[model samples]
Target: MSEGFEKCHNEYTLFTKTSKEGKILIVNLYVDDLIFTDNDEFMFLEFKNSMVRELDMNDMGRMRYFLGVEVLQRYDGIYISKIKYALEIL
Candidate 1:
């Protein structure tokens, strides 16, 4: 990790960094899966490039579903739903 990224005190698998402009980038790791999001587009690309350079990871692109939750990202905002999970249980 670079660019002053800091590990969370409460969670070892979580890392975060805040730019001087107050933009935040967060990354969480679970086993071999890594999830990350950033408010700054340039910062996001930088982190992605850094990770790709350092690890054998592939870009899965934007997340649609994770842990049974469906994610819908739109220009207005992001929306999350468990309708998919609920349908599976029924």
Candidate 2:
């Protein structure tokens, strides 16, 4: 393994809850970054607390930018659009 991977550490918390009794959900995490979706809000908070204790985390209060993608959330859903990203190619 590369030296970087050897020192890899978990640095984020994520929780997902479903309104129904049982549902399937997927969560993806990379280093200090995480992404997930669910109808349950409490599940997200519970996951956050567990992550904080283990990783000494800081909740940024919602994601503004992720992996060069800008996120704008509305009551309907999340909108991810890249601004000025196309110009950088030139």
Q: Identify the leading candidate in terms of lDDT.
A: 1
lDDT tens digits, residue span 1-90, model 2: 211112214633433334356643335567766565545566566655766777867777767778778898888998998775655666
Cα RMSD to native, each candidate?
1.5, 8.3
Query: Per-candidate TM vs. native?
Result: 0.88, 0.62
lDDT of candidate 1 over 1-90, digit per residue (tens) = 567989999999999999999999999998889999989999999989998999999999999998999999888898999998999999
**Candidate 1 clashing pairs?**
none
Report the Cα lDDT for residue 20, model 2: 51
lDDT of each: 0.93, 0.58
Least accurate 10 contiguous residues by lDDT in model 2:
1-10
Instruction: Report backbone clashes per prediction.
Output: 0, 0
Model 2 residue runs over 4 Å out of place are: 1-20, 23-26, 88-90
As a TM-score, model 2 comes out at 0.62
